[model samples]
Structure formats: C-alpha cells, structure tokens
Target: MTSPHVAALRSVALNVPDPDLAAEFYTEVWNLAVADRQDGAVYLRGTGPAHHLLALHPGEQTEIRNVTFRARSADALPVLAERTVGAGGRVLRPVAPVTEPGGGVALIIADQDGRIFRFVHGDAEHDVDTAAVPDRPVRLAHVVLNSHDVSRSQAFFERALGFTLSDRTRMMAFLRCGSDHHCVAFGDSDRDSLNHIAFLMPDLESVMRGGGRMKDAGYPVGWGPGRHGPGNNAFNYFVGPFGVVIEYTAEVLQVDDSYPTGGPEDWTWPPGRIDQWGIGQPPTPAIKEAQQAIRFMPAAAF
Candidate 1:
C-alpha cells in the first residue's frame, strides 16, 4: 500500500529570545514580510503562496519550535498519525484545528529523538507574488536537521511520513515528499539539532544578489555560493542572529518517483573542494558551531 505523505514543507516555527529583533532582521535584511502578529509572536511570509514561511515566538533561548509540512489531504493525517505511532513516534497532539496564524487542521508528532513536526491540511495561502524580485526568497526550500542516528531518523521519516530518500552523501541524507529533491535532510551529528534552514530564491541571480545583500548588511556568507551535488542547487549560507544558521538557495533539483537515489559514493568532491563549483570558502568555525547549537525545544514544552 502506498503510504500517506505531506505535499510540501510549509513553514518553521522558532523560539527566539527577541522576536521583534528577529522580525526586523528577517524583514529588513532577508526580504520576508510580516504576515501576522499575535501576542508576542511574529509570522513572516516569503513571495510564495504559503501563508507564512516562518513564525518567531518569544522565548528565553533560541531553539527550533517545530518544522511544519502540508499534508496531501485531510485523510492522510490520521493515517500518518497511525504510522507515526507505529514507527515509535508519539502523537503530541491529535489531528485538530490549528489556532495559530495559519488556520488548518494539524497533526503534531514527535519523533523518537524528540524532534517535533507538524503536518497541516487546509492551511490558508497568500496570493503568490509572481513579479521577479532579485533578492527575495519565494518559499522554504528545505530544512536540515542534525541527527544522532541517521538510519533511525531515516526510517521514521520513510515509515511514518512517507518521505523517500533522494540521496545520501557522506555527511547527510536527503529525503523528499514531493517534486523538490528534498523537503528535509538529516546531517549526521552526535546530537540532534537544527543544522540549517534553506529558503528558495527565485534563481541563481537572486541567490548571488541575496548573498551580496547579506554581506552589505554585515552578515558574511559563512559558506557556499556553490552548487551542491545531490540537489544541484546554488547556495549561500549565513549564521543569522541568535546562532540560527540560514541559507539562500536556488535551482533545487526536481525529481519524480523514477529518479534514482544516489549513495555517498556518488557525491564525493575532489580534495580541497566542498561543492561542485569550488569557488566558495569552507564553512567558518562560527557556522560550524551555530549549526549544532540550536536544539529543538522539548515536545512537552510547546
């Protein structure tokens, strides 16, 4: 039987020490607009149709609240919930109406390692901005999570979330639920943390322009401006405020069920090269530290 799946990665919620400051950086420097403000939280949107690509909430420390995805259909929710439990994950909240910025029926689940994921169906969408904006991101491309056990995490995503493995590199495993090469990826790490969040720029020009803009804003590119082998995407990464690693990427590979899944052997780079195009510098010490610093908030705390 074909497993139920999510249609796309919708948004990510983050707990930041100062939501307003984070909101300012995202709006002024990153090009995302404020979509909504509720209590002390802020919802930000990209040029895409998704209601909001990011939500920032006030917290004592910065941490990932949850990564959200859009379910293919309402029927998929209960089935996914069942599969989640079967895969050793817990249903943090049963399928119910979401009261947050994007109103939808959501099923919140926590993987065995305590990483939270929310699957929503019937969420509101904004009118898509079709005009080409040079440095603006259209939507979330993918989220990379650090996993202590790559195999176990991969199994849960496959069995419970119906995500297919797109590729497995030496340090990471990319998984997809839809056409985009990967909606989520797992970076092998000693602890479970958020590796980074990637935003989809309109094109290669936008990726470079955005990187320049970030540099102008005093945030240097921590790594990239290079094409990745597995996804074939051009990227520029930065360590944003509160040690949150963010990326601007474009030209992500799109694939169907017929696409072949490659192993680590297929993704090796030459000596002194980190990506397909070796023009970019390696990730800085700060970037490396930040990538593993933002842990997910305990499921019970949210």
Candidate 2:
C-alpha cells in the first residue's frame, strides 16, 4: 500500500476578472490580509505566515479551478513531482515556488481534471488581520471538489498526492491530507470545479457574527450557519471574492491511525434533518446521487 503523504493545504489560485474587488472582499469579509500582488494575481491570507492563503489570478474563469498544498520539505517536492508525471499526470508547470517576502518556495501541478495545484515548502504561521475586527479564522480548513471520476480523483490524491480517508457519504469522500478531518473532499459529479473552501473559526457565535458581518458587507449568506451531520462541523458558506465558495466552520470530524480506514466513505444527513443541535427546522433536500452543482445543507444542532 502506498503511504499517504502528510501535506498541508497552502494556497488556492483562482482565476478572476477583477483582482481589486476580489482582493478587497477576501481581506474584508474573509478577514484574510492582502499579502501582495503580482502582475495580475492578488494573494490574500490570514496571519499564520506564508504571506497568503488564496491568490486571485485574474482570468475569464469565474470559479476556483486550481488548489495548492505545502509539502513536508523541498526534498519531498522532487519525489512527488517525478511520481506525478510517471503516473501519467501532466506537469503543467515545473516544481518551483514563486519568490515572496516571506521566503518560501512552491511548485504547480495539475490534477486529472486539469485543476492546478501549487505545492510549496515552508511553514509561516498565520496571524489574524486585526485591521478589521478579526473573525475567528482559526485555521485554513478543507476544500471540496466535484469530480467526473471519483476513483481517479481518489487515486491521484492517495497514490501520488498523499491524502487519507477521513469520512464518507455515499458518493462524497472526505480526505485528511495532514491533521484536519479532511483538507480536501471529492464527490462524483458531472461538473469539475471547487465546491467550497473552508476556514475553521473558534465557535458558533463567531460564525454567526462573521456571517452577519459579511452580509452587512453585501455578500449575502450563500449557505449555512448550520452544522454538518457528516463532519459534525458548525458551518457557514458565502460567496467570496473570485467566484469562489468560502466556508467558516469549527470542530469538524478529525482522525489519525486510530480512525478505521476502508469501506464506502458514506455518511448522510438523514432526510428532513436540520441543525445538528436538533432545533426545529425544515429538512435539507436530497442531493442528486452525483450532480455537478453545489448543494447547501445546514446541520441541526443535535
């Protein structure tokens, strides 16, 4: 069995038409700081370090098509880079990091679906952007993907990219690439693009306040302020800058060797179940067995 690589999501590159507006939205609504701008790309991130977490690469595509992760070290980069190409995955770009003030390195690669992922080597601690009242963005969380082939997606992530299974729901599989329950998720669907990118907040209170703050900023709640039955995470999703779906969540499901591996990664939100806290509300509609569109389900407070 190929061992799963321990990698951390570093940054996600989004192709946008308006860099300025996208940059402002991320910094303001998401509470990530504008790290810097290159020719046409703008990078924004929370305070831990690395300078940025999301970079807006102005383009015609409105959704997020590329994702990146930071490897354990520079040494790991070359090995994975070689394995990726050997596995028939195209190396859209060579293994190299863009120069930044923080002094980190990154390499970009494309997944089976042609989604670009920039891999990096560095550990910069994220600091809260205090300019505006910092919403509790505890850490960069997971990203969900709608893929044409779940097996291919799973193979690429597990075989070459290095990720482990954290949980599942019929066709949706959550993977833990490092410490979190799932840094990335794959769902069998007709469309190919990022489903959502999540950030961990401190608590439900912060999540509601952040949602209100974002709404006040004009970005209405795209979804949530609900908990997920699958991951047990308190969640909120909103339309973020660069045509991306952004999430603010806390206490998602987590695992390690102790977590049982194998079996269909299936978990489900029982029909009409709303709020993980078990408050009275309407039930969420059932998702297509595998559709390309994004679906929103708020967890009932159990």
| lDDT by residue for model 2 (177-211), tens | 76567778887777765677788776677788888
- Which pairs clash (backbone N, Cα, C closer than 3 Å) in model 1? none
lDDT of each: 0.93, 0.66
Task: Assess candidate 2 and give its lDDT.
Answer: 0.66
Each prediction's TM-score versus the true structure: 0.98, 0.82
In model 1, the runs with Cα more than 4 Å from the true position are: 1-3
So what's the TM-score on candidate 1? 0.98
Choose the strongest candidate by lDDT. Answer: 1
The 10-residue segment with the lowest total lDDT in model 2: 293-302
Question: Over the stretch 102-217, how does candidate 1's per-residue lDDT look in tens digits?
Answer: 89999999999999999999989989887747789899999999999998999999989988999998889899988899989999999999999999998999999999999999
**Candidate 2 residue runs with Cα over 4 Å from true position:** 1-4, 63-65, 100-103, 123-136, 262-266, 278-302
